[model samples]
Target chain A: MATTTTPAATPGRTKGTGKPAGPPGRRPRRSLLPYLLLAPAVVLELAIHVIPMLVGAWMSLLELTQFHIRDWSGAPFVGLDNYRVVLDVNSAAGAELLRSFRVTVIYTVLSVGLSWVLGTTAAVLLQRPFRGRAVLRALFLTPYALPVYTAVITWTFLFQRDTGLVNHVLVDQLNLLDDRPFWLIGDNSFVALLIVSIWRTWPFAFLCIMAGLQNIPDELYEAAAMDGAGFWRRLRAVTLPMLRPVNLVLLLVLFLWTFNDFNTPYVLFGGSAPAEADLISLHIYRSSFQTWDFGTGSAMSVALLLFLLLVTAGYLLLTNRRRNDA
Target chain B: MRETATERWTRRIVLTLLAGFVLVPLYVMVSSAIKPLQDVQAAFTWWPRRPTLQAFVDMWSTVPLGRYLINSLLVASVAAIFSVAVAIFAAYAVSRYRFRGRQVFSVTVLSTQMFPGILFLLPLFLIYVNLGNATGIALYASRTGLIITYLTFSLPFSIWMLVGYFDSIPRGLDEAAQVDGAGPLRTLFQVVLPAAVPGVVAVTVYAFMTAWGEVLFASVLTNENSRTLAVGLQGYSTQFNVYWNQVMAASLVVSVPVVAGFLALQRYFVAGLTAGAVK
Candidate 1:
């Protein structure tokens, strides 16, 4: 919008200056300035993201390994063999990858679902002012504001088998369980990862939902009340519908971030996560870094990227269509 | 709407429960940071037997905590400054001008946010190595390499959010500066940027925090000399024992600046983040 009006004004104002204005001397310079301004971002993005991605795709087809890392050009180009090895269900790598994928999917769903619910509940409850609301709001956002490593490291300390407060509460104080459970390892690792993920993420959801609620008119709730609607009915009709746009973007972002989360698992489990909680990001990290198989790791990374891209595209399309239908 | 006594009780109970959930780990971090090392490693206690700041004092000697802190500070700050400076110009361009390929540029930058960091990690690592080999400059385990890698993390969101922020600023102010014979750069820096201080602060803090907490790249990219706190802190736990108390102490020290900065500027940061979506 600024573009349409500004360019027209520029030419007209320059014409009134009485210069020979068949493409003013400043026109080319002006046109080039935007590109000049954009140059740093473009170059950084290319060097950091775009070129790396293209190179990753290329590396997926090569037999790149630690042995060949210094001189990757010498690594033989293996046509689709890395993909075949990683995708074959019968193979160990493929089986592990599939299992990791399943774990990640379930983890993402639960983390995103629970986080959204908690955030929305807190936001709606806090929407109308009450005593100590500001303190509670700030307190709730503390986890999100804290560094991920610090928060997860704290969680790790709390989840320690012998000395963790979680077990101390559940086993020692509350006497809920007969045995002290290990949180950062084995079957319980999934639950631990999920709890930390939800804890770290829900505050973000609350922030977004709270921001979204500010835009919703109080008149809607009043109208619903006048229609003899109860709180639940008002929430269902007025609150949820009005929060759709926020929910759409928030949910998608949460889904992607949660799915691709490397920090929570990495810090909580310390690089090598248990099979139960091996998020795909960390799994790929181990595959590449641990096994020193850059080619297969790059293949898995490319595959994961494609899957995420597909999900994002589909999510946008579905959400856009729903908005149109509504 | 007015709430009944029953509803009020439920709200209070839920609020307390959620607050406890949020505060417990933080409580643990603070409590553990002061507890004696043996008290932390031996048993989990709600109250510290002998609470002391000895762990805080010991944390520095236990590892290269000071070096890690300095490295993290330097890397995160430099990356944040560069990302913000670059984003300001790019955001201004996208916000104020019509250019060929502007839409493609915007979309590409935004879409980069969706791709997982792992997708770029391996290749970026390789590129650093290869480029180092070719040019005789060490990027594989260098601070400059880490800073470059970190730009990708913050630059996209910085540009996107700043674009939204700049769009909200009225174009007339810049136009008035233009009519006053101020060039575009001058109009941007002297005229437009003054009004967008809050937005700039928000972006800078976001970028700094992102670089500060990042683990994935920091893990692989940095070695001993250039190790950041994110990876360096893990050194406290050796094969034989874990210095839990010292780790907690160090975590708190590193977390203070970021958490305080975020909470202080929470309003502006939230406004900048949700501006594009909520509108």
Candidate 2:
């Protein structure tokens, strides 16, 4: 991985043509061209992404109420009051935010863990040659290929109380339940959201793991098998070790995407999410847009962003340390 | 390795069951889209009893679905093309040239991906509102505003993907081009870029799909006239009378281009995704 990335990271470092030096005046101009070429993208990224982040942090500090939303410059400077409100566990709002944060954490852990495990299992199953593998691969990838709204809206229909397929299958066909279950409205909403989340995301994990599987040399597996290693033993000794780096990257990416995911819950639940399934993204969105509290919303988001940054840094450190130790 | 009969049968059965699990929701969606409203609500069937395009036809008249689709297409295509075009030049510079602050610039590009996009919503909304107020340019509820926002998210990933792609091309190609007296830009376009066509298409597909399915930004940034398909889909159920058939029909329509696009370019998409992860 390091070798593959170094070319882009420090290209032209080792390539000294050993040709006669260019004219003294021409070197500087030639060197500046790369910067010129990179300017538009750099500038746009800064203006569109970076500057707004700074502004968001600034907005979090102010008392930007709905009355002042139209012209925000005049909004009062609250100096962490918004953060205080969100963090004040004694307050009803703060207590709710804390509960939502806990909910978000649980959702992220479950969604990421299930997707990765299922994905890795599927990838291992299909790693070797098989008949009709091509068709099976395409079939497995269908969920990931479809747009999120399409998939989740279909889930919304399937989770309908009376007419949905899930209930029909469980109640009418399988006789598992006597009455229709309200999937979208209660504690079951969390279960419903998890099913949709895992359904949409597992294929992605499968794809990444499959790609990672390609890099494992076949010789190691052959040697292990010769040493009297069976399927589980060979997998544990050879495959998992080789897949560590890929899994690290995959896990972090999956966690981040799932944690920041806004579309799935929004589409499945519509405008306001049920309390049981209130992931932080929708919670913050409602606080800001639905209730017209941009300051509190920004503050909550800033907190979330800071939390993610800390988590990512810690994850990278732990993974890198483990890799080095191994 | 050779497999026994039971092992082969087991693999087949497990894979087939997984495939069925994957396809069931999609089967439900397509079937619901064509089924009559009564049939959809009253009882579930494997296939539509009276299959019709009436729902698809009615979706348009019901809520300006055509306009939403056209708006989504226009925004997605423009953003994809423009973002990829800009990213190619930046990618080339990073991949080929050694410049001051190169490491910092590259890391900055990667770091942008880590920030949650919702963090930008409030500030960007404020910026657009203020800019429109000052200049009388209507960005508050316009496609242009949405396009610009989408570009930010799309550009970073596109640049990163293209950099990996450009790096894979042998340096000898550029060196040979230079020997023949081709300028750096000319060599980039004439020699290196032609080889990176797969990467370009991969980036284009990625950017297009990102913009196509975007709901959070589109929901906030667009209104009636400027609404994209994503937000328009929301309107179908939010109104007093819920139209399940039309909603499903509209979603199917909105998803077709992206699904087809991903299937056609599945190879590139997988390559692009793995390139970033493994490297």
Candidate 3:
């Protein structure tokens, strides 16, 4: 009976023994110690990310503003009314909000996709370091580290219809354009933004994938080569598998960044006018900071926050499942 | 024992051609930055004929380039220090202890990177305004605010990287230390700290590069005194005219460190890139 009773206890003990016993009676509290170390970072990130999200959510429920400095009190609750105003077209705010979302998605998807392909290709090219490889790698990072205002301004100069390098090439040199195409005007507005977009962003993928490439073991390649694997075959089998985590991380990062991207687009295509190129960040700037419609701008922020939350949640779910498989 | 002629030729041709493609815009930028404005405006010239440093001269006197550079250096350094310091402890925790919230904490940090800055911009803007209003002292337009914000975004990556570095550190060292009666902190300081120097350096360099290069928050958050080199570049475009030569010069100015850092630590950066990545 005693042996059987002890044997019954073994299952729980065995499973528990697989993991170490953390500080007794201090499991929750012991964990809090690390968190205490983590407190400053948490507090800053909260102030930056979480609290604003909550506030935006809260603001969506109320008429929130910092327009006139004095009062700053919350108006009586109007549940989902801001969201209604945002989504409904008859309402001006709704039309603007809809515009913002449309532009935001376009910016996000294109920025993420184009940059990913370019960066990945660059990383692949860079997997081996030969002569001048070091210099070339350094050279490639220029687009990334160059100040946005400068790069955009440079883009602005390049895309300027007349007396621009691009126009000089397209019209005068190659004769691609009979007359200089107005690259920053109506039709070419977003196209100009896209050039700046690709130029500025492709480096992100380069950084992420470069990091990913480093993680792949030379031994794996050697073994595969010993088995007579080709370069493409090796990349497909070994490199891609190793790069999965960084790729996912980069995807999420690029998506979020492109979605929120303000500076490059804004500088290239100014906040006012250029509606074709204006992203949500620019739109929000127009509404809140420019138009001073605090309630609606806050609503737009809330909506944007929700969209980001969904994307991030989806990314997490996918990556988590992927890790589970591995 | 060696590559075939085909391999050598193919590598040479591909690499040389790609280098040309990469160098074109960069060459244009450098050429333009040194050229007189009229020369830049004229036909495409690979080499700026009669190259002068007039644009660089103009770039300095026209804007707060010196101040912005100082601001960038200061903010980047402070953010780097704060990021690395905070990261070391947090990274140690996440790596060493498999606590209940370990997974949650890591996920939170990773997810923080994916959260758009726009989501935080408005509320944080108000928060800063209020801080200014309340204390009669402000962080928003001050150098301090820039450092704070940079660290917030930067810490997560640094921490994430450091944690991966920490995991690679042999736990046997800790085991031996524990057997010899050294405490956890002692083990970390004596064993892990020395080993983690290279990674810590990489993280610091990364943090500096990020803070130095960042523009968005720098623009919105600090408009007046705390202008970054990036924000200062925007000054080239005024109400009526854009200073193309000067702007290109400024862009060249900003890219120096990232290029230099990569060159200086090319070996380490490549190595660290793969480090802390794989399980």
TM-score leader = 1
- Candidate 3's C-alpha runs over 4 A off are A1-33, A65-70, A74-76, A217-238, A270-273, A315-326, B1-21, B41-44, B177-182
List model 1 lDDT by residue over A1-326, tens digit each: 23222333343244322333333223333456789899999999998899999999999999998889778999999999999999998999999999999999999999999999999999988988988998998899889989899999899989999999999899989999999988888999999999999999999999999888888899998889889887689889999999988899899989999999999999998778999999999999988988789999999999998898899899999989988998
Encode model 2's per-residue lDDT on A124-200: one tens digit a residue. 88989777887777777778878788889889989988778999899988999998989999899999999999999
The candidate with the higher DockQ, 1 or 2, is 1
- Kindly give the stretch of ten consecutive residues in candidate 3 chain A with the minimal lDDT sum: A1-10
Q: Model 2 chain A — which ten-residue stretch has the worst lDDT?
A: A1-10
The docking category that best describes candidate 3 is acceptable
Assess candidate 3 and give its TM-score to the true structure: 0.86
Residue B159, candidate 3: Cα error in Å is 0.7
CA error at residue A220 for candidate 3, angstroms: 5.3
Clashing residue pairs in all predictions, respectively, total 0, 0, 2
Q: Which residue runs does candidate 2 get wrong by more than 4 Å?
A: A1-30, B238-240
lDDT of 2 at B162: 90
The TM-score obtained for chain B of candidate 3 when compared with the true chain B: 0.91
Docking class of 2: acceptable
Models sorted by TM-score, best on top: 1, 2, 3
Residue-level lDDT of model 2, residues B32-85, one tens digit each, is 899887888785667688998889988998888889889999999999998999
Q: What share of the true interface contacts does each candidate keep?
A: 0.67, 0.58, 0.42
Question: Chain A structural similarity (TM-score) per candidate?
Answer: 0.90, 0.90, 0.83
